[model samples]
Target: DSLVKQIDAEIEKYFSGENPYRFTQESRELYKSIGGTPFLDGDYTVFGEVVEGLDVLDRIAGLPTDSHDRPMQNVVILSTKLKRK
Candidate 1:
């Protein structure tokens, strides 16, 4: 989809040094240490964030994570659906 392509393009820009927020060595190392895998595995997509559940998202993001940035407990999405705007 177009959205997915856009996300991939943005990621490529950051990784290829075309974006101002390019990944740094320290960041990469930290990510690896925290067990954060590269975003290539499709765990996330362009249209994944939920506007109404942002508080929950913030809490999850704040959780204690391992060296690879994976949280100690698994956070699963039970389901997702779009609401009429």
Candidate 2:
């Protein structure tokens, strides 16, 4: 989370500049309704969604990480199944 905070600080510093990209109303509403790293709005690209096993996501998020932010335990993805509706 420290890295996220550091990135937030840098984003704040840049937000003072002219023509800074602001978070969209959709993103703002989503953040308010749920919760998220609003600072990452336009920063990262989400490739996929966890359709199930949210508990697994919570467990993974709670795991201890090293200085490089890599989880201490080796969490491997053996395979993935993508379904469309």
**What is every candidate's alpha-carbon RMSD to the true fold?**
11.4, 8.6
Question: All models: lDDT?
Answer: 0.75, 0.80
On a 0 to 1 TM-score scale, where does candidate 1 land against the true structure? 0.43
| Clash count in backbone of candidate 1 | 7
In the range 1-85, model 1's lDDT, one tens digit per residue, is: 9999999988788678563535789987887787654654346545444678788889999999997679999999898878766
User: What value does the lDDT take at residue 53 in candidate 1?
Assistant: 74
The backbone clash count of each candidate, in order, is 7, 0
**Per-residue accuracy of model 2 over 1-85 as CA lDDT, tens digit each:** 9999999987787765644546789967988898876556668987788899889889988999997578998998788889886
Best by TM-score: 2
Write out the backbone clash pairs for model 1: 33-67, 34-67, 34-68, 34-69, 35-67, 35-68, 36-68
Lowest lDDT 10-residue stretch of candidate 1: 40-49
